[model samples]
Target: MKRFVVRLLINSVALWLTTLIVAGVSVESYDADDTLATVLTYLLVGLIFGVVNAVIGNFIRIVAFPIYLLTLGLIALVVNALLLLLVAWISELIGFGLSVDGFWWGVLGAIVLGLLSWLIGVLLRPIMGRSR
Candidate 1:
């Protein structure tokens, strides 16, 4: 439970940072004037992303194993980008969350988000009592 919350927070922060660094990827706050609502919006988007990556992302990786091998794992970038786009679509259906401009933007955003998440995880490894 604690670990899950920590990961979710890490993802939320990484997502916020990604939006700042990527112009084409952004999240919409439920209430523009309410800071709490905005934070909740990010958290919700992060949760949705986590769930999508855990479920659909894993399925894609398994089914595309042959393609991944053939492409020397390069296809992972496209897979991750597609997963991000899926998250954006799901959030859109909810009416206020992540909005990705296009596939290229989704790719860039996924790259940024992944790097940020990795860095944060590494930095917090000691506190989390996990080793790489």
Candidate 2:
């Protein structure tokens, strides 16, 4: 659907920005000089990230609800970071995608990606129409 495509694009852009701002988090393209390949790489990573977060991320959140409550939701940062690392791992299997240096880098990258995604969503809300 249009909404899904829009979200994918938003996440791709956010990931690109995150890589630019975070030294430890980066994306590898099939060909550095090929803009289309680079763009597809980002989009592919974004899709993987979205899928991983939707499936594994939700399951973890549900199972860790008690811990989340105990930690006043602070555990979410760690969980998100782990999810980001999971994406990196999955991408690694494909030989070219997201590359996170370590846990701290994953945490920082997740924070940056989340913020950028939120900001982009807010800015595009009017154009995209109000959510139900």
Best by lDDT: 2
The per-residue C-alpha lDDT of model 1 at residue 66 equals: 100
lDDT of the candidates, in the order given: 0.95, 0.95
Per-residue lDDT tens digits for candidate 1, residues 6-63, read 8899899999999999999999998989999999999999999999999999999999
Question: Can you list the residue pairs that collide in candidate 2?
Answer: none
For residues 88-118, could you state the per-residue lDDT of candidate 2 as single tens digits? 9999999999999999999999999999999
Q: Can you give the TM-score per candidate against the true fold?
A: 0.96, 0.97
Candidate 1 collision pairs: none
Off by over 4 Å in 1: none
RMSD of each candidate relative to the true structure: 1.1, 0.9
What is the Cα-based lDDT of residue 129 in candidate 2? 76
